[model samples]
Target: MYYAEGTHEPIIAPATFEQAKERLRKIAQQTANRKKPSRSAFSGLIRCGIICGDCGAFFGSKVWNSTSKYRRVIWRCNNKFKGEHKCETPHLYEETIKTRFVGAFNAILADKDSALENCRLMQSTLTDCSGLDAEIKSLLEEIDVVTELTKRCIAENSQTAQNQEEYAARYNGFVERYEKAKTRVEELHSIKNVRQAQADAIGAFMFEVQELDTLSEFDNKLWLTVIDTVTVHADGRMTFKFQGSTVIDA
Candidate 1:
């Protein structure tokens, strides 16, 4: 006969340490094999990872338990939930936004003409970098002229052929101006490359936008995948803006 450790209940004891360890391991394995509760069984489950249009914030949903049998999932702004700024919008039911997204997506995919037009609009805004080289050439010429003037002023002042104070001031001013202008030119070149990259991304998105066959099959994932943002105005009119696609209101 054996007693449980720190308990008055008597039990059969393992004859050796190895037997005790084996018994404990069996109990642990049984506990490990127990079935976990399924989380997805609830009807009104809240979906997380949704982005807010007004404050550019991400929001999550929580299930609120009540005396009633049914569970209610409330989607609240993450900022307001975290005691940040008080977002005025009421907590939206997950179904409301999901319905709106499905409807909007279906409407967009239904119109082939509109989709093609959107692609055209995006393609039109893409900048041509072919003329960038010529622009840079002109800017370099201007910098050279400014530099020559600054050098001449310095040389004349050193020879005592010009007023020292005025020549020095003028030379320094020109040098500063030339340097600023050259920096701006370099910035423009860099910007051109960035713009080209953005254009390529938009172009790829446009190609996909034009190929969509139907919108009814669109889900939340599809909406997040294609849409950049959806803006709801004060007048209750909401605009669904897509990535590299034009807005076509229904």
Candidate 2:
């Protein structure tokens, strides 16, 4: 079942693998939580959550034979034939997507405890902002030092007949230092905020996983709570990415 055991060259380099992951990450961030009401359980998720693997486009929902004896609800790439090139990926029926999702859910449920533990560990790691906090604190202290120097420079210039040009230069240098330190502190705080948001998402996913029992059907509520995105490959394979960035290929 293993692809390789280091006895041969890797199918893909680590850098390439990371680049693909980064692209997927950006797409997931843009599409996750785009909840739109529709007839399908994964309606809103169809055009956003379920993505085309070959062309990197969202799958739009389509309903055929609406007024006939047989009706078909399918999802296909939104940009299938929009450009000069066309996507070779096939469309997925709602029933098929649901069935695959159920299998993926059960597979994860089979390792529920391990998954929950890993999520908790990840949440803990992301929530810990000690390093960023320390850096921010140091920058704030530097800003305070620079502020005091600026005040001293101004006071000395006013108290005695000092060269205005030299005094202005010193004051401007202090101001520049203070501004840089303040800007760095703001950037660090922004980074901490993003980490905390990720931690919160992991915590929410963990809570949902802890509450669920055996999953026999596709639960819309649970799916929304756990699924961040889904990728449908050209070969009819589907990969479900749950909250906390845990992925299950089915």
Best candidate according to TM-score = 2
Which regions of candidate 1 fall more than 4 Å away from where they truly are?
A: 1-88, 93-99, 129-137, 154-162, 190-194, 215-225, 233-238, 248-250
**Ten-residue segment with the worst summed lDDT in candidate 2?**
1-10
Over 4 Å off, model 2 = 1-37, 63-73, 153-175
Per-residue lDDT of model 2, residues 49-162, tens digit only = 888898998999888998887877889999998999889889998888888988997887788899898898888898788898789768867776777777788878889999
Candidate 2's displacement at residue 86, Å, is: 1.9
TM, every model: 0.54, 0.72
Please give the RMSD to the true structure for each candidate, in Å: 22.8, 14.2
Judge candidate 1 at residue 14 and give its lDDT: 19
State, as a TM-score between 0 and 1, how close model 1 is to the true structure.
0.54
lDDT of 1 by residue, 1-250 (tens): 1111212434643123334565599678546644544343212222223445556565566678845678877665566545656655456665665666667766766775776676667656656655765776677777777777777776677787776677768977987778776887767766665665455556655565567666554353365456655554323344666666556332
Q: State each model's CA lDDT, in order.
A: 0.58, 0.78
**TM-score of model 2 (CA atoms):** 0.72
Worst 10 residues of 1 by lDDT: 1-10
